[model samples]
Target chain A: MAIAALAGFVGALTGLGGGIIITPALTLLFGVDIRYAIGATLVGVIATSSGAAAAYVREGYTNIRIGLFLEIATTLGAIEGAILATAVPTSALAVIFGTVLLYSAWQTARPGPVSAAAAAPDPLAARLRMNSTYPTPEGPRAYQVQGVGYGFGLMAGAGAISGLLGIGSGAFKVLAMDRAMKLPFKVSTTTSNFMIGVTAAASAGVYLNRGYIDPGLAMPVMLGVLAGSSLGARLLAAARTKVLRALFGLVLVFIAIQMIYSGLKGAL
Target chain B: MSRDGGARRWTDERIEKLVGNLLRAGVLISAAVVLVSGICYLWHAGTGAAEYHFFHGEPSPLNSVSGILASLRTLDCRASIQFGILLLMATPVARVAAAALGFYLQGDRTYVVVSLAVLAILALSLSGYWVR
Candidate 1:
């Protein structure tokens, strides 16, 4: 529980949900089964996402319209991924998870520009009213959304990865919104955070039905992540997140390598 | 300046606030339930006994709703934990439902349909309709 709490704090600070840390820790340090770890990590993901998003939504950084619209794709993809989870070999899942982790590491290492391009909005985005404003210290900042199709496709893929691995897949979501959709960085992050809980919940339902959600394992993880994220939100202003993020990114790379090695050896 | 437009904004804010608080409260209540149940579970089964290396298949007797409910009636710790997790899972579904209502009230047909589609997918997952 304490480790989960720490993982949640780091995840919240890093804007990656706790599952990334929790899954690797459970599998590596505690000798927990990958399937059980994924199940427990899903609960933790929901806890942190929902707990943190409550504030983000009220703060207006989260674009509710975009979140709801994108969820149409994410939830569907999550269901399909959950169905696949039951049949896919665990070793294969580990390899895929490791690849995602490495990609996330590269993403973190090279932060992309928050596209302020004055490009024309997609017809679908305009029809859906995907353009929105986010509150800033100065005032409300307006931004236009573009690439609706690409963003939706990316979100569906992110949701599939999330369902399979039990992480928020926030890196991909942020990439979709910030790069493809051309939303501001803050809006993209908060909106991604808001969307993750629902995305995870969709898959969690399937995991629950599959009996992957063991109460004995999930209870502590859920409670621990909730407490940790709440505390992390409080400490965020004081924490030097740049250094912490770099350190965490390194940790992710290391874990990714380990996961790949284990998967290759059929020992995951 | 129209009353309809003014009312629409009012309802939108109301729904957003309600949904935010609903998510907050759901997490808190479910976390509390999980905490207490965890404590009980830990007391019953010592912490050091979990063998993480082995794959112990599905957790039986608490896999289905009926099974969880039956166990919960007896105040079983594990069942309570599962129930709390269930409540946590329900939070987002409830949020989507509330958002759909919000869209309907705002007369936004596109979003209403979108939210309902998301909800339907979630419902399908929960219904175990896709189980093989």
Candidate 2:
């Protein structure tokens, strides 16, 4: 429970989810089965997303319309991924998971420069009215969204990975919105946070019925992650983003290497 | 168009506040349920050994909603935990349902349709109609 709390804290602070940390920790440190770990992590992802999304939404950092629209793609993809997870070999799943973690580490380590705002409003975005203004230290900064098709495609992939691994897949969501759609980082992260819970919920039921969700393990994890994320949400406004990103990147790289090694050795 | 923008912004703020509170309440209530069950689990089975290296499917008694409730009636700690996790899972579905309603109330026909699609997907998964 304590470890889950710590993972939730970091996850909330970094715009990731507790599952990213909790999955490996459960499998490697606690010697838990990969399937059970995935199930438990899915529950923790829901808890953290719910607890943190509240604050982000009220702060106006989240775009609910964007989140809702993208969810259609994600929910469909998540169900497919969850079903496939049952059929995939554990070693292969572990290797895929490790590769994703490495990608996450790379994503975090090399932050991209802010893209130039589009002069021409995207037809799809304009039609959908996917534009918003976010409050900054200066004032409400207005921004226009672009590349809706690309963003939706990316979200589908994010959802598939999330379902297969029982994670939030926030890194992919952020990339989709921030890079493909030109949403601000704050908007990307908070909206991703808002979307993640729904994505996880779509698959959690399947896991539950499949008998992967162990109550004894899930109880402490859910409560701990919820508590930790609630606190993390409160502190996010005061956090140093660059420092957190750098440190979190290092952690992800380390974990990724270990996971890959374990998977290859058939130890996980 | 500017006037329409102003009105949209106003509605957006209101919806954001409402949704925020809803998410917060869901987490709190579910977490509280989990906390109670967690304490019970630790108290009763804290010292027990649990193996995690291999897959052990959950017992039939804890697999479904009906089964979980039945176990809870017997004061089973594991059932309580499952119940709490169910509530947690419900939180996001509730958020999606609320968003659909909010769009309908705002007369956003397109978004209402979009939100409903998302909700339908979630509903299908939860019902075990499609995922199974």
Candidate 3:
């Protein structure tokens, strides 16, 4: 539970999912099965996403209209990925998890893309009314959405990763929204948080039906992450997130190595 | 977006506030249930981390929606905890349903259709479509 709390704090601080820490800690440090870890952490993902999103939604950072439009692809992909989780070998899942961890760490180290070219609007985006303004220091800044089709495709992949790995896919979703669709980083992150719960809930049902969700294990984890994340959000203004994010990125790398090594050893 | 041939009953702001309340309330209630059930469970089950590290699958009652409800009459701590988790899971599903309603009120036909499609997928998954 304490570890899960820490995971949530770091996740909120670093814009990473708590599952990245919880799953590795459960499987590597605690010797819990990866499958069970995934199941339990999926619950935490829902808790944190829903809990955090209320504030975001009310604050108007969440583009509910845009989010709903993309969710069709994500929900479809999530179901497929959840079903795949049942068939995939545990060692393979570990390998995939490690690879994703490395990718997330790399993504964390990278800067947000500057999409100066995104001013041009797509007919599809305009027709769908995805173009909107977010509040900035100056005023509500209008931004045109480009590449709706491409962003939707990436969102599908993000949902698959969310289901298969039990992470929030904050990195992947930002990649779709910020990089592909050219939403402001703030809007991307907040809207991603808003969308994550629905994506995870799509997988949650499958996880439950597969008998992977252990209440005894999930109870503490869910509560701990919820509390810790809320606390982290509160403390966010006081903390130096740049340094913390870098340190967390390094931690992700270390955990990734450990996961991959153990996975290879197990496979052999 | 209002093409519904009438004044919309709920403004987007009001609906957004409702959604925000729904999400927070769902999480809090579920967390309270989990916390109480967890304390009761830990008191009875003891803090045996060793056994819990293994992956022995749960029984049918703990694994299915109907089963979770049916077993609640017995007041098993695990079942209660599962029920809490079920509520947590339901929040987002309900949010999607609420979103559909919001868009319907706003008369955004495209978005209403989109929201319903996502909700249908969630409903399918909850119905054991993947598992069966």
Candidate 4:
């Protein structure tokens, strides 16, 4: 129980790959069932989303409009993903999901700069008026969103993966918003925070209907994650971004390797 | 980069006002619901009719008729319908809130309408009638 809380605390501080971390720890270290671990992880996802979103909303960091708009695609895609997961064979899905997680980890480890050129405002971005600014040491600077359509499409895909794999798509969503849409890093992160809950909620309902939710497992995870995420939110302002990002990247790589190993072992 | 642009600088004073309004509204609505629900629960508990269980399967004292009645009255299926309605309403509310917050934070309204539209869709989807 203490371990779960500590893991959740660290996970929340780092944008929640904690469940991914904890699942292995629980199964390998504590000998809990994988099924139970996954169930608890889902609850943790919800708790983290809710806890982080409320603070982000209060702080005015989240782009609620964009987040809400994109949620339509994500929510629908999540339902479809949940449905597909049940229909497919477990082993086949495990191999595919494991590969995707590895690819995602690799991509996250080497994030790129937001834009190459201070080019003219993208026509689509200008038309949609999808440009905004934020506080900086230099002063408030405007950023224009590019490739919103592409970003939304990617979010839908990521949402489906989230539902199918029981992993929060924060990293994927952040990637899409940051890389494809050209949103500022802070805005992308906060907007992703706002939308993840809705995406998780969509699939969570389907999972509940399918009897995937076990109350006993969910209770402890949810409570622990809720507490942890709240604490993490408090620390966001004080924490150093460079150090956090490095730690986050390392954690993702480790989890991806673990997932690959587990998948191969299960197949064998 | 222009002379006109120099005139338009981000001001914390404007942002604070917008955030204050949103906080006030959110608090007002959330408090109302909590208060009403609390009253209903207390009334049921006093009457020995309302009943509920805690996480560990312990029977709560308010599991009698009054308890059930209060729950049904205060938070019945109709409440879900109402929540769906509120969610729909909240999209625009969220948009306004976002716009207000964004304006306060950045002196811009880039996502106000976009946020409201999303809320509207969420409300429609969650309405239950649509799902049925």
Q: Rank the candidates by DockQ, best first.
A: 3, 2, 1, 4
User: Which candidate number maximizes TM-score?
Assistant: 2
- State in Å the error of residue A227, model 4: 1.5
lDDT of 3 by residue, A85-113 (tens): 76777677678777887987788677655
User: How do the residues B14-127 of candidate 3 rate in per-residue lDDT, one tens digit apiece?
Assistant: 677889999999999999999999999999898666455667788988899999999999999999999999999999999989988988877778888998999999998887
Candidate 2 per-residue lDDT over residues B67-113, each given as its tens digit? 88788889887788898888888889888888777777677788889
Write candidate 2's Cα lDDT for A99-198 as tens digits. Answer: 8879877876887665447456578987887899987888899989988999999999989888887888777887789778888777887898899999
Candidate 4, after superposition: displacement of residue A167 in Å? 2.3
Clashing pairs in 3: none
For each candidate, the DockQ is: 0.74, 0.79, 0.82, 0.09
* A13-65: candidate 1 lDDT, tens digit per residue: 65567677788788878878887888899989989888887876776777888
User: What residue runs in model 3 are displaced by over 4 Å at the alpha carbon?
Assistant: A100-108, A113-118, A235-259, B1-11
Candidate 4 on A61-110: residue-level lDDT in tens? 56654676577677777666766765665556666666766676676667
Winner by lDDT between candidate 4 and candidate 3: 3
DockQ-wise, the better of 1 and 4 is 1
Interface RMSD of each candidate, angstroms, one decimal: 1.3, 1.1, 1.0, 9.1
lDDT of 4 at A259: 69
Error of 3 at A160 (Å): 1.4
Report, for every candidate in turn, its global Cα lDDT versus the true structure: 0.79, 0.83, 0.81, 0.56
> Order of candidates by TM-score, top first?
2, 1, 3, 4
